[model samples]
Target chain A: MKFAVVVFPGSNCDVDMYHAISDELGEEVEYVWHDVDSLDDFDAILLPGGFSYGDYLRSGAIARFSNVMKAIKKAADEGKPILGVCNGFQILLEAGLLPGAMRRNNTLTFICRPVKLRVENNETMFTSQYERGEVITIPIAHGEGNYYCDEQTLQQLTANNQIVFRYEGENPNGSLQNIAGIVNEKGNVLGMMPHPERAVHELLGGADGLKLFQSIVTYWRDAHVVTT
Target chain B: MYKVKVYVTLRENVLDPQGNAVKGALHSLNYREVQDVRIGKFMELLVEKSDRDIDAVVKEMCEKLLANTVIEDYRYEIEEVVVQ
Candidate 1:
């Protein structure tokens, strides 16, 4: 499967995401600049993390207006799997691709460390490789990672099984219900603050995040493979 | 010319850790009567006069960029300015 790693100015993790997909996962990947108006060539989209637009007005607020977002929206409507990590998650929230918004960490500090996440749901394309109720370690780095939404929206998320990952032991940034990641209602889009690409190597930390990438590839191949 | 002042704040139910920290500092400084505190964003915009309704323009800006309606509430005041 071909992947497009969206690159915005100040996106520090774009290379990491590319390396993870191309080297570790052995998938075709390329860096797609934020100014590009078309995303027709890519089968999957990855929005990497960084202080886009300097995180000026708000995290992900300014980056949401980038030209590429329109194409990303179009890709999402076509049911292409899209993953947003860290600042990318913030952008998805600001762009209304995913519900809710991020607030300052309850500690009012930029937290950067490894965190344990529980697989809340294993049916989605992103987490299908993870065992149900399995715990995995991934690194999180951000200040505005506290996720917030109304009570009603939270209920809908729970009912739809959209809550994909939850903080296993301790909530690092005080996210609501220890929510570490979530998917859209259609299950094609996922936004999470943790850096899964960073965890794809055992020497770097752990290879727990590789399965997520593998799951996406496996799902795409299964659904798209044609019989002659 | 017109001067527009905008205030953007978190919704009532949302938690503000920075505000809480500031409140704690005030308490430590012996300001006992402080009941609550909320931190928000304040922006000043100078807009040129035009035929379009100023209120509508400011409202649209607030909704589109200045404030995120999902978690924030915004209010703005517009004042006509007389240049020398």
Candidate 2:
């Protein structure tokens, strides 16, 4: 499958995602500059995590207005698969592809460590590699990673089976319902506070996150347009 | 013109480390009367009526990007005012 990763001014993880997909997974991937007006020639788009725009004007606030995001919004409406990780998750929230806002870590400190996440719903295209309610540990790093949503909306999210991942043990960032990740109602857009790309290689200490990318590849392959 | 003030907060299920730190400080200071503390972010948006269906547009902006209606609640109002 052909994949594209957007590169914002401050996107430090762009290479990581690029290498993980190309060098590691041996998949064809392209890097789209943030200023690009369109997301053509790619099946899936990824907004890898990093301090986009130096996390100024709030983490994802500034990056939300980036040129390519407008294209991403339209693509999502067109049923394209878009994944946002870490700061990418913040950007997704800012882009409104998913519900909930990321707040300052209740501890008010930047946290970086491998965190255990519970797979809330795997029926979606992203996490189908694991059973629903399964647990996996991946590294999470962010200062304003706390997630917030209203009570009723939280209830609606749970009722609709839209939640994708949650912190398995203690809530690290004080995310509502220990939420680590969530998908849009259509399940094509996913935003997670953890860094799955960072955890994709066992040599990196844990391969727990590889399943996410692998799953994406498998799902796209099953759809039959992909070249192995 | 319309002005919308949106306040965002973490839901109860999420941990509030800032709140916890404040609570701990309050107790340490011997001010046990303080029950709890939580922190939230606030945003104010101003849009002109000529900006195209300001109300609907703003609502869509909030839902699409501004506020994460999930853990935060946002309310807005219309007004005519002068800025010096």
Candidate 3:
């Protein structure tokens, strides 16, 4: 029921993530600086999007070396649910928490708009609230969201149902197999380029992304809270 | 001193949009016979003499920070320099 939004220098989406968890989802949330070494107090870890380390060298490359990443790895090993959106997704890839890497959008442009995403698998802790094959509108904003992995890795992902979200219509960034998001083999860590926190309110455009946050809370309650 | 020149390029299986764009530009300029084009990054590092093996050091640096082995391939040339 508690969330820690990891804040790196140049992290622009930390506030948005905090707002989503606190105001929209009504959950306990706080900002954890990248320098912090431990995340023992938080139940879920959220890595927000931004031009971390100014996206120098490569997106998420420099930020991966931050002190907090070691603790994040520890959290992953403990099976804590971690969500990385946008550049946060890039960081997770660089940190090796998730597979694959991002590349320049095939069109070579920064894309920003709401795109339809099909829920590829609904069994993961993050997407349990979404119905299988359900189409939801989530906004994506990035220039290097083109996800790539070796063929063998792709086969494993497909076999394990790790590919969580796929572009429903046109592949905006030319991601392989229209992959918009994926989860680790354990299914606890999710890295997606689309901004779910940004779409928690209907007024903003759509409320389709709210279920993802709700799903995390549901998973935590099921594991931690005992029924009378 | 050692001057290390590192070159990092996308793996053969990966696509390079920037390189493709540049190739398109060349074609528009009427430069036929240009078979293919690929883009990559170049970096220079000045390393002071150390007890560690230079080749091993450079390789470790490239694998750890300078390049991502998943999607990128890196090569380096070391030039020993005498500092005054």
Indicate whether candidate 1 or candidate 3 has the larger TM-score. Answer: 3
Residue lDDT tens for model 2, A126-159: 8889987888989988998888886777888898
Best by TM-score: 3
Better of 1 and 2 by DockQ: 1
Better TM-score candidate (2, 3): 3
Candidate 3: true contacts recovered, fraction: 0.84
| lDDT value, residue A94 of candidate 1 | 98
Native-referenced DockQ of model 2: 0.41
Model 3: residues with Cα > 4 Å off, grouped in runs: none
The C-alpha TM-scores of every prediction are 0.98, 0.79, 0.99
Q: How accurate locally is residue A126 in candidate 2, as Cα lDDT from 0 to 100?
A: 89
Q: What is the DockQ of each candidate?
A: 0.87, 0.41, 0.90
Worst 10 residues of 2 chain A by lDDT: A219-228
B82: Cα error in model 3, Å: 2.4
What does candidate 3's lDDT look like per residue over A172-227, in tens digits? 99899999999999999999999999999988899899999999999999999999
Model 1: per-residue Cα lDDT over B1-84, one tens digit each: 999999999988898888899999999999979988899999999999989999999999999999998889999999999867
By descending TM-score, how would the candidates be arranged? 3, 1, 2
